[model samples]
Target: MTDSQGQTPDTRRDFERFYAASVKRLVTVVYAVTGDLGEAEDAVQEAYARAWPRWEQLVAEGDPTPWVRTVALRLAVSSWRRTRNRVRAHFRHGPPPDLPGLAPDHVALVAALRHLNPEQRRAVVLHHLLDLPVEEVARQTGSTSTAVRSRLMRARRVLSAHLTDSPDTPTAGAGRPATAAQPRQEVLPHE
Candidate 1:
C-alpha cells in the first residue's frame, strides 16, 4: 500500500528507521560544525525532510548519512552567510534610536566585544560562546587551527583587559571574579 504522497509502507518504514537512528547524532555533528544549536537543528531537519523524497535512492546507495550530513552542513553555511549579510547591513544603516537599555553587565560585555576586530570577535564567539573546538572554528573561519588558537588567546587577553578597565563592569571590582569577561570552557565534548 502507498501513502497519499505515493510512498509505499515499506519505504516509509525504512525512512522512519533511518531518521530515528541518525537524527540525534547528525544534529550533534552539525552543531559542532556550525557552533549554533538552533541552526544545526534546523539544517538537520531540512536535510531529513529532503531525504524523505529520495529514501529509496538513498537506500540503494547503501548509506544516506553522508548525503544528509553534506546537505545539512551546506544549509548551515548558507544560513550563516545570510546572517552575516544582515549584520553588515545593520551596521551600515545603524541601530534604531529607540532601542531599550541593556543591563550594566551586558553593556560592559558589548563594550568589550566592540574593542575586538571582526576576526577576533568571530573567533571569540565561535570558539568560546558557541563552544566549538579550535579546529572547527578554524574550518569555519578559513584559518588554521593554530591560528584559531592564537586568535582565542589574543581575544581573551583583550577581553580581560577591556572588562577589567571598565568602571561600569561589576567584574571590574577587585573582589569580584571576572568570570563574565572570561571565555568559558565547554562542558560537553565535541564529536
Candidate 2:
C-alpha cells in the first residue's frame, strides 16, 4: 500500500520506527538547548513533521539522526530568538514562576544550567549530556574543538558553583533558615 506521497508502507514504518526510537532523546537534547522542556518537545515534533516528507531521501543517503537533530536545534534556536525579547521583558519585571512537578535536583540542575550562556550551555549539553566528543560537538556547533573545550570548561565551572549550596542558601521548602553546610556538589565535573 502506498501513502499520499506514493511512499510504500515500509517507508512509513521506517519513519515511524525512527521516530519512536529517537523522539525522547531528541526532545531531551532540544530541551537542553532551549532550557524549556515544552519548547523542546514542540520543536522536535515540528522537526519530525518536516522530516516526514524527506524521509526516503534522508534514509537513502545516510543516517537521518544528524539531520533531525540539526532541524530540531535550528527550530529551537528560531523559537528562542523570536521569544527572547518577551522573555527579557518578563524577567525585567519579575522572576519566573516556580515550576511544578519537577524534582528539586532537576530544578536545581536546570537553574544551574541557566547560568551558562547559550554557547556554553550548548557545549555542555552536547558534550556532557549527549555524550558527544569534543570534535563532534565542535562540528555541530560550528566551532573549533579548542573553542568547544573552552566553553565546556567555563560552563562546568559555572554549573559547579551554582549547584553548590551554601549554608546561607535557602533550601527549597525548608521552614528553617538553611541547614548545616552541605558538601560542594559537582553538577558538572572538570575534564
Q: Compare the candidates by TM-score and give the number of the best one.
A: 2
Residue-level lDDT of model 2, residues 1-191, one tens digit each, is 88798789999999999999999889878876667877888999999999999899999889999899989998888888899986556434432467656677665666677677889988888888889999999999899999999999888777766666554556533322132346687798789
Worst 10 residues of 2 by lDDT: 172-181
How would you encode candidate 1's per-residue C-alpha lDDT over 1-191 as one tens digit per residue? 88887899989988888899989877766654444457779999999999888888888998897679768877876886789766456445533344346455554555566556656776776677557788887877779998888888887778777666446754555433365456657799789
Assess every candidate by TM-score. 0.47, 0.79
- RMSD (CA, Å), each prediction: 11.0, 7.8
- After superposition, candidate 2 runs with Cα above 4 Å error: 89-101, 166-191
Residue 176 local lDDT, model 1: 35
RMSD of 2: 7.8
Per-prediction count of colliding residue pairs? 0, 0
Clash count, predicted structure 2:
0
Error of 1 at 172 (Å): 21
